[model samples]
Target chain A: MNAIEIKGLQKNYGDFKLGPIDLTLPEGCIMGLIGENGAGKSTTIKAMLDMITAGGSIRLLGKDARESSALLKQDLGIVPDEIGLPEGLNIRQVEKIMADSFRNWDSKQFYDYMKRFNLPEKKAFKTFSKGMKMKLGIAIALSHKAKLLILDEPTSGLDPLVRDEIVGILNDFTREESHSILISSHIVSDLEKICDYIAFLHKGKLMLCDEKDRLLERYGLLQTTPEILRDLDASAVLGKRVTDYGAEAIVARDKVPQSFEIQPVSIEELFIIMAKEA
Target chain B: MKGLLKKEWYAFLQKPVTFLFPLALFVVLAIQTKSQVILMYLPLYFGILPVTLMSADEVSHWERYMHGLPYSRSAIVSEKYVTVLILSVFSMLVSGVLLFFFMNTGFAVPQFLFLIAAAFAASVLLPSVMLPLNLRFGAAKARIALGVIFAIFGCLAALSVDDEGGSRFQLLEKLAGLNISIGALTGILFAAAAVIMAASWCIALMLYRKKQF
Candidate 1:
């Protein structure tokens, strides 16, 4: 079964709207949801999790998000961008609460992560720094052995040292082929490193989604004369910018005949190029 | 449910205010035996602060985190009622022990029992008002709503006391009718209150479960 699927999802805020988004993430793969600030990435994630009273259809683990959410959430682990840990709940108290709350909570694994993260066992969470608080969130999300993990910018404020540790943890989870991760982030480079697939969202709509390598292979920017730009099919172009001298344009990388000069494009560059329309 | 209650209990203990509960009343009790009026009132007051209004768990926005865990929304709400129930019982016991030492000379058990029950009811009402308010408007707005309600009640209560035989006086007259024999009546009131609480709790749970975080 696919780990996650969303279709025609709609949510309206007074000033902002989300979705009518369609996307999927297969089991045992990392799908990076890439978007700029205020681009509706968080809204889509909240709706998919049924955290919001959303307007369309969403399915996680093949069950509708609203009707069968409780059962579906069992296999899912989520870390929202904001810290949700209750202050003054030490690590020990958190474990007790989780153990009672999750049928599949792994005691040994939870404690093992606490040890690995160097989190204080008895220190109150109110005293925890931003990075430490995030570590606590990650520990809880990972220790349950969830089949589908959803994270919202899990590394926003961490030092590089802690960030690498979390990346290593995500990599290990996917390597086992029994788990998948859907990570939403503006940190395009981090997602590029770990995500096997990519979904780009802009203004609450799905712009593009494809295999990571296929994206690199299919989309390319060719700097050329306006005359050459006209030679390209306007239908094949995602977006374009024309300067006084020439036009820089996005075309299917492989479709741009080998006869033409080309260079590799980074994921961030692709997001900017695709999100910006003529 | 036990897990949730335990968390609530620990949170209460961790808060210095809950600790101040006994401290503040003890000072009042020390001044004069008559001030057992203040001692009898302490538990309900703490209930308002700790159980209903300014809890640490709510401060941290922990309910959002707890949503996907094993507990159901109904379970979470039901546990809150149970927490207040347990706290009321515990606070009643503490009030009894202190009342014992203060009224050791007289053993006025009937009046004392009435006072304890009144304290418990007063404590429970705060949550009845607060739980719905908090669920509807959230903490920031709940504070303002609760403040306004309290201020209005405070002003009216003072006016009623200053103006002899007002509706406030009649409200107390109903309580003053209690005696040792009225324990059965108190028990019935507790039962009715429990039913109303359960109904309110169901509403809060459904509204919260369906809410957009």
Candidate 2:
């Protein structure tokens, strides 16, 4: 079964509109949503969670998203960019609250994650650092035994060490075949490390969605003179940069002539090129 | 529901002084002055506690985070109403104890019960107006709206005095003229408060459901 399926999702504010987006995340696979700021990544996530009234049909675990029942929520764990626990709540109090909130809450797992993450049990949320807060959020999201996790910018502002640790934890989560994740982040490198599928959003529209490996295979970076780049087919060059010394362009591998050498493009490079082009 | 309450409980404990100061003041003043009139304001204070908590929730952005949880919109709206009711009952119980002590000071048994009922009605009625506004416009804006409402009511109340030594004496005289028993008046107040509270809950739920975080 697919973990999440969204069809024709759209939301409109007076000044901005996010739209008609269709996305599907297959069960047990992680799909990374890559976008720049205001690219509608968070908006799409909100729509899928039914946090906003959007024009769309969303199904989570075969249940309608609008049917936000406790049973449906029990199987879904979510982490927003900022963990929004009351500042005065200590770890123990948060555990107590979660215990009362979720019938399947595992206190042992929570404590274990706290210990592993080096989060202080006695400290209030207000005292925790940003990295600690994020670790705590991830710990809570993992301890609940949720089948699907929706994380929004979970690793955006963290240091590289903390980001790597979080990435490792996410990798561990997907070890279970039933556990899936739909994570949105502007930090493409982190997503590249863990995501099997990639979806790029630019200006509220989905630019492309495909397997990460397929994207890397289909697009290659070409290093040549501006004249050579200019000579290439417009359709072949997805994005380009021409300096006085030389020129570099993202070219469709199949469309490029065999005479030109094509280097594999990283997901970050691909996203930047694609987003800039859009 | 339990989780939301637990959160509020922790929040209450965080600033116990903020929540308990009014009650303590009411107790001290009632004891020192030997007056039951101060008991009326205790429930009014308790009724606004939910709005105060909502301000904290706004600062922490818990309301937005809560949407990611399993709770429905109605549950979210219902929690505030429940919190108001809980605080109202606590205020009533505290006032009941105070009224019990006032029994020796010429306070009649029926009047004592009526006072509690009146306090309860005021407690629920205040939040009935405040919660919907808070849900519709958020905590900060709702606070302004509430201030305007209170100001209007205060002005209307001031106008009703007719310069005849205030409205309290006039109200008592009118009530006496009506010849309604304290028991019947208490029942009417309780029934009116209940109906208003139920309607307020529906309004709050509707407003909250339409709100986009």
Candidate 3:
């Protein structure tokens, strides 16, 4: 069964509209959702979790999210962009609270993660640094034995070392074949490192969704003359820019002539090209 | 639900020093007035305790976080009600004990019971009005809304006291002179407060269910 399935999900704010989005994440894989600020990454996650009343439907682990959300959440762990640990409580107190809050909360696992993260148990949450707060959140999220983990911008502002550590931990989390993850972030590099599949959301619409390998294989950075670009099939070109030396275009690697130079494309470059095209 | 309450319990500890303010005030008033009457106002202070806890929840944006947890919207709404009720009842019980020691020599037992019940009723009234407003508009906006409401009511109360003719206070004073027993009056007040609280809980649940965050 797929970990998450969203169909025709739509949410309309006065100034922005999200969706008509349909995406699915099969069990035991990590899917990265990529978007710019205000591109509706968070909205899609919220809609799928039924946090907001959206226009369509969602299914998590084969059950309708809206109808059986509380039960479904037992197997779901989420780390939102902003951490919400009570400012007054120390990590020790927070442990007790989580222990009481989640029936399946594992105290030993929580303490183990805290030790692994090197988080001080006695320090109040208000006194902790931003990075420490994030580590604490990750520790709580990981300890719960969640089947499908959802994270939003989990590594946005952390230092490189911390980001690498978090990425490593997430990679380790998916070693269990039954576990799946749906993570959203603007940092394409982080997503590229850990994600099995990538989905690009541009202005609330999905630009593309495919396996990481397939996407990398399908699109290439092409440098060619404008005249040659016109001769090439219009459908083959996803986006183009006129440079001082020549015209740079993102084109289908398979559709271009053998003579045309093709370079590898990173997810960041792909997202920028697609966002500009939109 | 236990986990949510535990979370609030720590959040409740956030302002431990502030909790002493009311106790200090009560001590000073007790020394100055030498009357048990000061205990009656304890409900008003304790009622605001729940509102203060809600402010902590807002600062942490807990409502948004709770959506990711294994809690229903109704459970979230009811948590506040249950927590506030516990805090208010605890406050009333402490005041009742203090009232016992400071009771006037000639004051009857029925009047003392009425006083305690009235204090409890007053305690119920604040949360009953404030919880729905807080849930509907959020902590900051709800605080402002409550401030405006209190100011209007204060002004009306002052005007009624000054006018004296056909004022609600006068009606109440005249009722006190009637043949109704103190126990009966307390029962009526308690019953009315109970009805209002039950209705408020329902309204708050509905408002909270519709709230976006």
Candidate 4:
């Protein structure tokens, strides 16, 4: 069964509009939402979580997200970009509060994550550094026996070592096949490392959605003279950038001539090219 | 609901010294003055506890965090009301003890029950007026709005004093002269405050439901 299904989701904020987005994630797969700062990544996540009123349908675990029973949320975990731990409380206090909150709260797992993350249990959240705060948020999201994890920029501002640690933990989380994750991040490298599926959002619109490996296999960066680019099939070009030195364009590798130099295109480069074209 | 209450408790603990300082000061004043009337204001000071908790919630964006949890919006709104009531009742108890001490010391606790009821009414009324504002406009904006509201009330009060050609003391005297017995007046004020609080809870719930965060 699909872990999440969104159809015709849209949010309007006067001059800005985000949506008509459709997405689905099968259980056990990790889907990464990549977008620019104001590209509606957080808005889409909020709508799916029912944190805001939105105009469309969203289903989680085959139940309408808006209509699901509160108990149904026991299997869902969330971590926003900014850690929401109360400034007054320490990790110990948060544990107690969370224990009371979720029926499925695992105290053992909570302590384990705290230990693994090396978070000082007695330190007030306000005193923790930015990376520590993010780690604590992840610990809370994982402590519950959640079947699905929804995270927004959980690792956007962390040291490389910590980012690697977080990515490893998330990769381990999906081993059970019953667990799925939908995460949003502007850090393309992080998403490329762990996400099975990738969705690109631009200015509130979905630009593309495809399997990561398949997308990488299908597209290549072609650098050639502008005169040669003009002769190349326009239908195969996804986006193009013309430079004084040469013209670089993204095209289906299968359709492009083998004689042209094809360079590797990272997801970030692909997004920048498309966004620039848009 | 239990977790929500626990979160508020942790919020209060952020500055445990601040919470205890006011209570201790009020208790000391009641003892030093050797007066039952002084004890009544204890509840009014305790009124700040809910406001403090509200600010703490805002400090870390805890309200937005709550949306991710399984809690319903109504439950979130109801918890603040419950917290205020708890503070009010606890303060009333402490004041009652201080009043008892004055009675034993021959300080003459006149109209004791009425004074206690008035304290409770004021405790409830202040939060009723403040929490909805805090929930709607947030702590900082709400505080500014509250200052404006109090300024307006203060102007009306000053105008009333000027029109009567009397000091604020005379206004107290006028209220003291109301024909009703102290018991009946206390009961009426308590009942009215309770009704206003109930209405305020409804208003706060509506405001919170419409709030994006």
**DockQ, each predicted model:** 0.52, 0.74, 0.71, 0.58
Relative to the real complex, the DockQ score for model 3 comes to 0.71
Task: Give me the displacement of residue A237 in model 1, in angstroms.
Answer: 1.4
lDDT of 2 by residue, B1-213 (tens): 999998888999999898778778988888778777777888988888887788888888888888777788888899999999998899888888887875347778888888899889978988899899998899889879988998998988877776565664477788899999889998998899889999999999989888877
On a 0 to 100 scale, what is the lDDT of residue A106 in model 2?
96
B104: Cα error in model 2, Å: 3.5
- Which of 1 and 4 is ahead in lDDT? 4
Instruction: Judging by DockQ, tell me the better candidate of 1 and 2.
Output: 2
Question: What are the runs in model 3 whose C-alpha is more than 4 Å off?
Answer: B158-169
Write down the lDDT of every candidate, Cα atoms only.
Answer: 0.76, 0.89, 0.84, 0.85
Q: Tell me the chain A TM-score of model 3.
A: 0.97
TM-score of the B chain in each candidate versus the native B chain = 0.74, 0.90, 0.88, 0.89
Q: Candidate 1 has which clashing residue pairs, if any?
A: A9-A20, A101-B70, A218-A253
lDDT of 3 by residue, A1-278 (tens): 99988899888898998988989899999999999988999998887677788888899999999899888888888888888867888988988877776778999999988889889989888888778888888888888889999999988888889989989989999999999999999989999999999999999999988899999999999887888888998999998877678787889998988888899989998889878987
Best by DockQ: 2
lDDT of 4 by residue, A1-278 (tens): 99999999999988889998999999999999999999999999988777778898999988899877355577788889898878868888999999988988999999999999889989888899888998888888888889999999998879998899999999989998899999999999999999999999999999999888888888889888888888888887888999889988888898888887788888888888888877
Kindly list the per-residue Cα lDDT of model 1 for residues B1-213, writing each as its tens digit. 656666775676577665675657564673466565676466656556544433455678777776655465667667766766776677777676666765455756666676667657655766776776676567777789989999999997778764455465676566557543667656655676667667767777877676667
Q: Indicate which candidate wins on TM-score.
A: 2
Score candidate 1 by DockQ: 0.52
Rank the models by lDDT, top first. 2, 4, 3, 1
